[model samples]
Target: METKNMEVIYQKVANILVEMIPEEWEKILLYAEVREGFSQIYFYYYPINQKQPVYSLDIVDVFNIDKTLHRKLKQELYECFEKLWNEFKVQSQEQLASLTYILDNMGRMKLNYGYEDISEISSEEKQDKWEAEYLV
Candidate 1:
């Protein structure tokens, strides 16, 4: 895809996030991983007084976003992530088949993408690594 087009897609994603996130929350973090035959994405929110995130998919209900808008956001996010995965594969010369990313907040827009072997790692270890990398 062209750089301009990607930029537009990114903006669309940011816009959706802005609309969906609650005003009272400090920030929300989205983590996604795509590999071979598996892919998943989840969101976690940090409220003003919370030390740890209150993880939930209840954002849809909380935001009171209509089903159509929710579907649109999901589609845009999936497409953007698919493009990122493909680009990573090309840039890395196909050495990596898996890609994961942590996208935090809209204004700060901290995006960190990398590849890791989850099959060999413990879930606890994965959680620890993510917290260390992004929560701090």
Candidate 2:
């Protein structure tokens, strides 16, 4: 996908997150720009800190170069999102709201150069039924 398209998609994903967990909105931060032909996208969430302005949360970085990578990146983004959503669903409304507020304001964070990959065992591999599973 094009850099412009990737940025648009990233924004949409961020908006979806904002809508789902409005209280945690402050924890969410997005920094994306086009450099050369690639779109460098960073998604972050920070903990709350009233005294100091800056806080840091987890960050996911992706380089979107084509439709395949774009799709992969979106899939990964949603998986993490789902995990957080489920966790928040069990919390009180007030607590949820507070968390969302912290997420929403996570601002001006930058990406580091090094990258790490998160790996998990495929369900099929775990079950020893490769044919029954769909590849991501």
lDDT of each: 0.60, 0.34
Q: How many pairs in model 2 have backbone atoms within 3 A of each other, for residues 3 or more apart or on separate chains, i.e. clashes?
A: 19
> Model 1: residues >4 Å from true position, as ranges?
1-12, 22-24, 47-56, 93-106, 119-136
- The most accurate candidate by TM-score is 1
Query: For model 1, what is the C-alpha lDDT against the true structure?
Result: 0.60
As a whole number from 0 to 100, the lDDT of residue 85 in candidate 2 is: 33
lDDT of 1 by residue, 1-136 (tens): 2355445655665676666555556676776666656555556777777777765467666666576776677767767666656655555543333333334444655555454566576556765676576666
TM-score of each: 0.63, 0.28
RMSD of candidates 1 onward, in order: 4.1, 18.8
Model 2 lDDT vs. the true structure? 0.34
For candidate 2, write residues 1-136 as lDDT tens digits. Answer: 1244434433556554444331333355433222222233333443355322222222122222344545565555554434433333444221111111112454332222111221243333432331132111
